[model samples]
Every structure is written in C-alpha cells, then in structure tokens.
Target: MRTLPIFIILLGIITINSCSKDPETDSDDQTKMFTDNDVLEEIRNNTLFFYQGDTATLSAAGNSPHGTFKLLFNQTALDALGADGKLAAGDTFPTGSLVVKDVIRNGNTSFYAAMWKQPSAENANEDWLWYEAFLDGSLLVSIDAKGNGCIGCHRANTNRDFVNSFDLH
Candidate 1:
C-alpha cells in the first residue's frame, strides 16, 4: 500500500534528523514543509495557553532536554482541543494543526519544539512534521537531516499530536 512507503520514509527522516544537527539556513529549502515565519505568525494571531491557563503551575521537564516551558497552540490546535481543553482518549488532531512548545530557560525562550500536522489518509496520525530550533532559527532537529528521536519521545497518545507537553504536565 502507499501508506507503507510513507511510513518508511517518515521513519528514515526521524532516524536521520535526530542524529544530525543541521543548522537551519536561509538557503535551506523549507518551502514545502514550513518556515520560521509560520511559527511567528501562529504565535501572533492564534490562541496561546500555558499550563492550560493555570499560571501558578509551570511544568518541569521529565526526560526532556527542554527545562521549564509552556505549550502554545494555534487556532487549529485550540479548536481541536475543544471545550474540555483536552483531547478525549483515542481522539486525534485534525490536519493543518500546529502546536509550539517554548522551552524557557532563565525566564526567556531558549528554544522551541513544534509539531505541524499534515494531510494524510491515516486521519492525521503519523503525519506531523517535527521541528525544533533556537531563537535565531538554528535547527536542533530539523524536518530532515539524519535518526529522529523526536518521534519516539513524542508519541501521539499523550493528549498530543506527537505532543509530549500536556500528558506529563
């Protein structure tokens, strides 16, 4: 089936990108995937929630390289969360959703970990474009490069669409 090849390609991308630290460059072709401006645009115009709006609680990392941080979801992601402010068990995020995690260090964002859901026949499952980078667009983990540990660490069942932020928090 077509799905099988897509899965293999995805696995390879994850494996390769995780092991490689390709700094995001202007010359890098991210047009078909995503760009830094897309992240900024989401932040500027969409809903942002931290600790699900419980400001007193800032979640600490569990086996995450990112220390203290907040999770922000764009309109698509927020809409997906629905009234409960949480995804029901077994429910998956819709296509075109974007969620960004701000890894705060010393009161400022040291880096970002983000997920973007793409259209696929799998109901948006396993279709996320994983990305992580520093403030100046230095890619820590790109959509491509070399073993993407990002997928392994960020399993979908965690009230996430490859989002590890909410479930553990």
Candidate 2:
C-alpha cells in the first residue's frame, strides 16, 4: 500500500535525524574549535570582547600560572552580568556562556585560559567546560579532564559559580 511506503520514508527520516551528531556535545570538536590554537588566534586578532571594558586588568592571582591578564566574555556571559557588570554572589552563568582570560607576561602573551558553559550530568566544573592552553596549542587541562587543579582555586569564589574576577574585582 502507498501508506506503508510513506510510513517507511517517515521512519527513515526520523532515524536519520535522531542519529545526527550534536556538534556542541562532541568534546573533540569543542576542543578543536574553542579551546585550541584557534582561540589563541582569536585573542591575537583582538576579536574577543574584553569584560567590563577593561583593557589590562592586573591578575590578582599572583605567583601562579596566570600573570597579568585581561578578561573577555562572549555576549551570553555579558548578558548574565547585566549593564552594571555585577552579579550578586551565587549567580551562575547560563549555558552557552564563554569566558576567556588572556594571560600576558612582560608585554608578551602566551596563554589563553577559558571556560564555556555546557551542561551535562558528568560535568564537575559547575556545568562549565574548562580549557587552559598555551599559544602553541599545548593543553594545561585537556578538554576531557575534570579540571580538578583549576577548581581548587576557583572554589575561593564558589559563590560566584567558581569565577573570581567579576566578584573579586
């Protein structure tokens, strides 16, 4: 019957759609596009929006991996902060938010640290995907890692969803 053929076609379409891969959930793809050298390139090209319009915010995090740095945020993160660039303690950035820390040393930059909010049941970084890498694309914390070393310090700002700059600054 013609109806039987139509049902088969619809089933095939549903199967294909259901099996399609979601780019956002793929760790490999996220690392390639967001956490790797492409991000360094973006920083070098000055395409990212600096947070709170601050060009160079001296890193309060002293004698550590991060030296002098500038904070940058995507539109989603900016919206979470509102026009005042302030959030009451415990406010968390929503999914799709991106935050970057451009680390500079002696007028030369060689590291780009970032966090992207992607909620998942296994996420341990407060639903954020942690990424910290050097300019050469070497990873300090791989995309698949849970970011334990990072979360340790970030816990100081636990109320701010593990982000320190906005709350401390």
Candidate 3:
C-alpha cells in the first residue's frame, strides 16, 4: 500500500543522484585563468619605484601619451591604509609630491606643461595607484582617478592578500 510508493520514491532519488555530476569536482575541466606576466615584468623593471626599494627613471613613453607619476612611501602612511583604506587611531602619513607633464589638446594644437601636487600622499597602493591613459598636450584629464570606486570596490577582497598588486611575475 503506502510502503510500495515510499520504496519507489527512494529508488527514484537514488537513481537521480547516481546520474548527476558533482559540481565541485567539475571545475577541473575548465580552462585556467591567467594574468599577463609581461605587464608584471614591466612594472618590476620599469616602475618608478618598488616596495623592495628599486628605482627606475621612466622614459617619456613609459609615462605614456598622458604623463608620468611617482611615489614616495613611508611606514606611517602604509599603516594608515590599514589592510584596507581605513585609518586607525593616532595615524599620521607623510605627503609625497607628484609631478606630471600633462598633455592637453585643442583641435590641431597640442602642448604640454608640468603639474604638481594636486593630490599628494606617501602610500603607493593608496594614493598613487597606477593606470594607463592618453590625451594631446593641453587638456589633461586623469582617466585613472576618474573612477576611484573601481579600485576601492574591487579591493574589498582583503582576505585575498590585499590584492593591490597583481600576481604572475
């Protein structure tokens, strides 16, 4: 009576379970994702400064069609950035200087000039986050700073080793 129907349902469940794939193990069949090692190498060899105290004098093209930027790091500011951008108590950060040869353009005319210290801080990951952009030599717009939340939001994953710098070098 009722026992026969219960047995049939249990049998059907066992059959379905045996036929289904386990999702966790199936990820191995997917292609591996990768970051470009060249970019990391460029950053290491050509970056103006590095955490390990290496230095580079950037070429005009290294700065690119927009301009160049630099960093000056100190422990106070690095601590202020916390594991995230938040500051703890008694935190004081050194202000670093930034010099840019901004490119501005008006129609066929292009010119360049130096801009300095519009914003300044001593933390590389916090203040001088890197980006790539371009313009003529007259009207300079920071394509990088235009989107502040883009980095900060992505950096929400602090557990994944801060991730301010990419891997694959």
Candidate 4:
C-alpha cells in the first residue's frame, strides 16, 4: 500500500514538471499578453533609458505640444545604428530593438513614446509597434493599429528608417 502511494506521488510530480512552461521561453515570446502595468514595471526595473545628450524640443503645435523629448535606444538598437555612425536611408532595426522617447513638460518627465521592432514575419505590413504612456500611472496605449496616425507620419521618414530623431544622434 505504501509503494502504491509513492508511485502515485512520483507520477504526479512528473506530470507537473512536464506541464510547466519554460520561463525563459515565455519571456521571449513577443506575442504573449503583456499588460501596460507589466511593461511599465519592466521599463522601470530594467532602467531602459540611458542616453542623455540633447533634449529635442518641440513647439506648441508639434506632436509633443511644447514638450522637450530625449531619445533612448537599447543596446541592440544602439549597436545597429552605431555600426555606421549614422542610420542610413534604408536600414531596418533588428528584432528586439527598442527606442524610447522620454517627454518632459514643465521640467518633469510626463510621458513616454516608444517603438518596438517585432520580427518581420510577425507583421509583414508594419513590423514596428508603437506605444505611448503617462509616466505617473496611466496604462500603456498601443497605437500600431492606427497606422494612419503614428505610422503614417513615420512612413514619410523612410530614409531614417521611419524615425524622426535620427537627426538628433
């Protein structure tokens, strides 16, 4: 009788182990459901912003509406852009590349705009996903589906790989 209980416990352990998902694999899956809170937590924990040179200032009628912004690139994206000292006319950022624009209003960081480069196969039409979020506590806003708004403006800058801050670098 004791042997039977031991066997059942062993079987249960094996089943649980087999059903569990790999954390590393799950983290790398871009399609996974990442909530705004989750992304904000990651950005805060990872210290995603690093570059601190010049602040790109905007006028009242501009996109940021009288805000000063700074562009920050992840190491992977920085390597790709730095390889040529400047991003050429048709250079596409590799998958996992992340660009963040920190927007400042009244000497305080109010919000952020970000772009995440997805695998080309994921979105054949537009591989880059756009996001906006308030720094205080608002949820992330995904604007990729509204291509005509954000994507349309970026499309005009094909030379800089659909980025407006390339000149700032």
**Top-TM-score candidate index:** 2
Clashes of each: 8, 0, 8, 0
Q: Can you list the residue pairs that collide in candidate 1?
A: 14-147, 14-148, 15-146, 15-147, 15-148, 16-146, 16-147, 17-146
What ranges in model 2 sit over 4 Å off?
A: 1-47, 62-65, 121-124
* Candidate 4 residue lDDT tens string, 4-99: 999999999998787676665564554534344544554465545345433455433334332576667776677677544456667778876677
Q: Compare the candidates by lDDT and give the number of the best one.
A: 2
Q: Where does the lowest 10-residue lDDT sum fall in candidate 2?
A: 31-40
lDDT of 2 at 29: 57
**CA shift at 11, candidate 3, in angstroms?**
4.3
**Candidate 4: which stretches are off by over 4 Å?**
1-34, 47-66, 83-85, 120-125, 143-148
After aligning candidate 3 to the native by TM-score, how far in Å is the CA of 122 from where it should be?
33
Q: Which candidate model has the greater lDDT, 2 or 4?
A: 2
**lDDT of each candidate versus the true structure:** 0.65, 0.70, 0.33, 0.61
Predicted structure 3, TM vs. truth: 0.21
Tens digit of per-residue lDDT, candidate 3, span 1-169: 8899999999999988876656555655342322223212322343232223334322234213332322223343334344533333333233332222223343221322221111232212443333322322122333234324334543443442222222211
What is the TM-score of each predicted model, taking all chains together?
0.64, 0.67, 0.21, 0.61
